[model samples]
Target: MGLRSFVTDILPTTLHTRGRHAPTLVGEPEVETFAQLVDKLGYLSREDLKQVRAAYKFADEAHLGQFRASGQPYITHPIAVAALVADWKLDAQAVMAALMHDSMEDCGVTKVELIERFGSPTAELVDGLTKLDKLQFSTREEGQAESFRKMLMAMSRDVRVILVKLADRLHNMRTMGAMAAHKRARIARETLDIYAPIAHRLGLNQLYRELQELAFSYVHPWRHAVLHKAITRARGYRRDIVERVRSDVDKAFGEARVKVEVSGREKTVFSIYRKMREKHAGFAQVTDIYGFRVVVQSWQECYLALGVLHQLYHPMPGRFKDYIAIPKPNGYQSLHTTLVNPLGTSVEFQIRTEEMHAIAETGIAAHWLYKVGTKSSANPAEVAQTLGAMWLKSLMDIQRETHDASEFLEHVKIDLVPDSVYVFTPQSKIMALPRGATPLDFAYAIHSRVGDHCVAARINGEPAALRAELKSGDVVEIITNPGSRPSPGWLNIVRTGRARSKIRHYLKNLEHEESQALGEQMLTQALRAEGMALPPESAPEGTSVWPTLLRWSGNRNPSELMLDIGLGRKVAAIVAKRLAQLMQEQGQRPDAVTLTLARYAAGGEEAGATPPSLVVVDGSEGTGVSLATCCRPIPGDEIQGYLGRGEGLVVHTGDCGVARRLSARDKELWIPVAWSEEPVRQFDTDVQVLLRNDKGTLARLAAAVASAEADIHHIDMGDEARGETAELRMRLSVRDRQHLADVLRTLKRSPSVLRASRVKPERPPG
Candidate 1:
């Protein structure tokens, strides 16, 4: 029988309905009438179809009373979704998953129950389709992030899970017109931002197209309607152009002795709208709105067709791409080229082999062909890798490291971004990263250790900044320093959340260690001031020191108590008193004079008998006593500490405007703080110098500051000045206030110096 005759004859002739129960299955019932559907799904045997049917029946029974917002039976939605998956010729398990997509959420079906009924594979797919309703989150964004996290992690486990989920989402999006306006908008936005990109990444072209069209309609309804109308009208006008192009391409290929199938392809409404927005053009200004795909039998014919097309029209300059040689990360392979036709209109042409066309159209779904056909050469691993399923590995890693749902969601979003660049490693392997990612992200992409020790990088054989934005096709090589660690400043510029989070985790632990040491030292000094001896490093197994410390700080353990004390959550005076009590209980008594001095210090009076100890203010330190970034206080400045909520004691200069305002309003928040006799590290001080606009003036100023035993950390000069004076903001390192004063004096004595003053940078209230 001819193809048309077979299709027409196999079409359903009778309609059956379970009146007042299930709706009648109407139109094209070839599967039930003649088992044509089973015959066509060559990859699935009769046994597989029987299993799938059993799953469908189970899901139908489970969701018997449930209905969707549109008032249709819930089982219909899953059936439709499953049909869509079957259309992709996915595996039997994936089809079963699609059929039961809503069972867990709507019918109270549990994963364990599904596993017992449909096996682990089907249960896992259903689990992936399940949303995060069980997880508690403070905000809608957090919940959404968490749901996405769960979905992506599931997808990483088995690519089939996402395929089924995408099918489920696609069916819902197709029927979204029945949803509320606000819900439709939100769902559409999410689809455009996430699901569509995921489909594209998986090389599900048909699914991607459907998702984009549905999302565009809800996101920009009016624009979408207008574009649809315009496309319809344009198609009418271009009917002859399409035919002419098709005929010329056919003839040209014939002349070149290359067999090809030429077909006209119209641009989708979403594609047109995107082009118009990106190029800032009106509908009429948009070229390449219509294209032709030339599917040939072999890669050689694809190249031959490309040459034939170029000879047929004036090829546009720099408008050709050879994707066949290096398929996109999504595994899309085609020879794309744009040409100016005889009518002076630009048109795009895509040339590809029949197999490439299949892959391009179905994406990773094409891998199923191996199961159906005699060609069993397809590599499942390669297909999975090409579809970017490796990103799922990171999801597992993220889950292992982070327990916060919100943070997990954030990591998933960072990893799911569609705009990615594929860069080459030194070993010639490819690493994918989001657009605007830097070399540091790339290093981290390879391995966390590489990122931690990455001191420098080279791009394409030339030295580049670690923060340099990577582009597609670039070869990057990381240079590591063995002793190097991730810098705190890197957090400000790193694009990937993984890199940022890892850096923060490292810094937090490092700061805690330093703060513990500092706390220990401060406790020792305070004890010495009380004329008491230091405690032993390790207490006896049954000693009460640990319990005493925990009671004093209201913490569960010694580490927590120490961290609280170091963070200034517990005052030093209070902790010292508790320590003294514990020591007295241990039969250690303090001198009467020492007790008097401790009492005086607790009452905010100076202990003249004891000298003040040293406290450091290096940028490397992180404790409750943090120097305000806004002020960058040096040792010479009179600083006070503010015990902020959650934040420990934030130090600010006494003269800082912010500190003055905070003290005026909340005076009790401020605590007395004095610089140590010998600061452990250099301090940052700001100096403003007004210099006459003269050559070598900045050099002279730098020399004068250096002459005073100070090093310049940063310098900011104003743009062109109106008069002879130019303002310069300089950050200098000094040991003490006297050192800063000496630097200021030397700057005032410099030549061409119009004015000089200590610039007190404003500090943020803690």
Candidate 2:
């Protein structure tokens, strides 16, 4: 008999008769049995099945003493999972991997052993399924993340690895009820949050639905039971409605001269619960509970059937979606239209070709059906290839960038969200984005460089802010600027984790460069204070100076030595002493009197230098020190330094409220610091100007500050009182005490100004 006849004959037995104890067949009924499962191995050659069976037998023996919590033979689980793969019509290697997925982890079998037995391809698949048992993690969250990372990296190399893994997870979820209560909930929640969505994104509707129902049962048992009972009762009452709809669809298709098969579909319990919860309604309020699907012979027939249904029933306005015309990102295609049925209830109808229907129902697994047939129009493998390629490519991209499993999982979670808005590029190429993604996300989705240089954007030919939230069907065109750089604030608005992580990575590297430059300066200044010029541009002759420097700083390399000094991990003075000693041993000496003078002068300079030892506040050369943004310090303010772990000397005013709390709590991090003569760079101070209500008062205040040769970096002007007076907090830069005094004088002279004073901004407590 043909495969189709075999499928038709066995469909009932495979789907419905498994749990039922039926009477034994008499006189050898023509029924497909477990032996047929072996016969179907023709799709994968008999020899391959023999090898797979050998591996299965080995796994069975390795798990001989083991049994599941349900008291079933441990081998039965692998067989069931392998059956799922067989149902998917996977190639021989995938089948072998599925059969031995648990061997490495549960049976203590090694990849080497599997390789020697089943060959390398099968062994690699088994290895990919193994967890990182030997590694230690700081927390369960960390370990889980790392494990996900490894799986994704492995998946990038072979799409079959994840497919088999997902199949394994699906089987486990189906049987999760046998596990303990807490374990069930955790596993179910993970399945719902991670696995189910992944399955959906990969177009695995069959696995997706099963996983959802399984997870829903455990995540909300009471709700699942209630919904299941309600659906069961509702199905009984709606039996007439279903039959009528089916008859109506068939008759309508007959009238349209379109041959079609009509079927009734009921929403799953999990779907019903989700609609109720999401819409904030009771179960009765949820519509679209009853749906009908029309499967036809061709795409043209699908449209004809859709027309026939709409002509028969009134289609709800704006409730129709023609995915066949514009497929979803996951390659799901169907013509969906919701209409008001004869019963005056909203009924959703999905019309598609038989092949499309198979894909819609079974997703990538529909490839199995085509493999068994020779229909010219049916090519499920091509469909699976198209849908799976993009998803696997993205997984590969994420794995290449992230090594931490938790972080990889995070990226996957972000990528897998079902809520996506479809947008168009300037050239009209469609792109789907996670909801709430901004223009920056669109740029990054196109390319990393586009995101990095994206300065502005336009939606529908009108300029929009970079942070503007994108919606479906919008035509987006990113505006690039050569000098634009990503700001720290972008982290707050960007939705996609890819954009966020890339921006953060770039900024971190930029900060490191700045820190390195600052560290080099500090080291040079410290050496100068020690009455020595910088060592020869290269290491001195015959000294092995790099090793000597490493020994002195207790570091691995010169870069690390400099980074330590720059980050205040080691004192500059101590490093200077070591450098001086090294210099003296390298045939360099200083006069006793010159050294004495240098000591006294250096002491005076140190006393007057910036509070942070690394920061040099020169009154003359506008170059060295900077006040911390966290707690901005000005001249004449009592200040202290915070060796902020990785951050170099952060100067905070001593009497500032924020600094006091940080000092009280983190005394070990606090370090002494002072100012230098002729301070070089400008200092920023906050000055609050309380001005009488006036029109041009704000502009005049800014002009006055500018006249005083002080620049205003930022300004906040708003009503502080209910009426009349308004307060303006201005963060302005000044050269020194004299410049700040001049600016304050000018501001005080303004007629509209009621009160003007430099106020110390309060900082957050440590």
Q: Using lDDT as the measure, which candidate wins? A: 1
Poorly placed runs, candidate 2 (over 4 Å) = 1-42, 368-386, 520-556, 564-601, 605-613, 616-630, 633-641, 660-759, 763-766
lDDT (tens digit, per residue) of candidate 1 on 1-766: 1012111221122211211111111232312211343454566788998988888789889988887876887777777777666777777888788878878877788999998988998899889989887768888988888787788777877888788888777767766656777887899898888888778877778678778877777777777666766766676687677667766776777688876777666667788888898899999999788777888888887887888888899999989988887677677889999999887889998998777887787788777643321245755534654456555566676676666777776666676676777789989887768899999998887888999999999999999999899998899999998999887898776787677767766776776676566556556556655666556537562265657666657888666655665665665555766777778777778877775654565554354444232354444455446887767677667777765544666788777777778778767456556666567788877888888978888789888988998999999886765667888898888887788888888888988787888876665567
Report the Cα lDDT for residue 332, model 2. Answer: 78
Q: How many residue-pair clashes does candidate 1 contain?
A: 1
Q: TM-scores for all candidates?
A: 0.83, 0.81
Give each model's whole-structure lDDT.
0.73, 0.72
Native-to-model Cα distance after best TM-score fit, residue 191 in candidate 2, in Å: 1.2
Q: Give the TM-score of candidate 1.
A: 0.83
Check candidate 1 and list the clashing pairs: 636-737
Q: Mark the regions of model 1 whose C-alpha exceeds 4 Å error after superposition.
A: 1-43, 369-387, 426-428, 511-557, 560-615, 622-625, 660-682, 694-721, 733-739, 761-766
Q: Give a tens-digit lDDT track for model 2, residues 155-272.
A: 6666667778888887676655567778878988998988888778877776787788767767777666667667656666776766676667667766777776666666767888
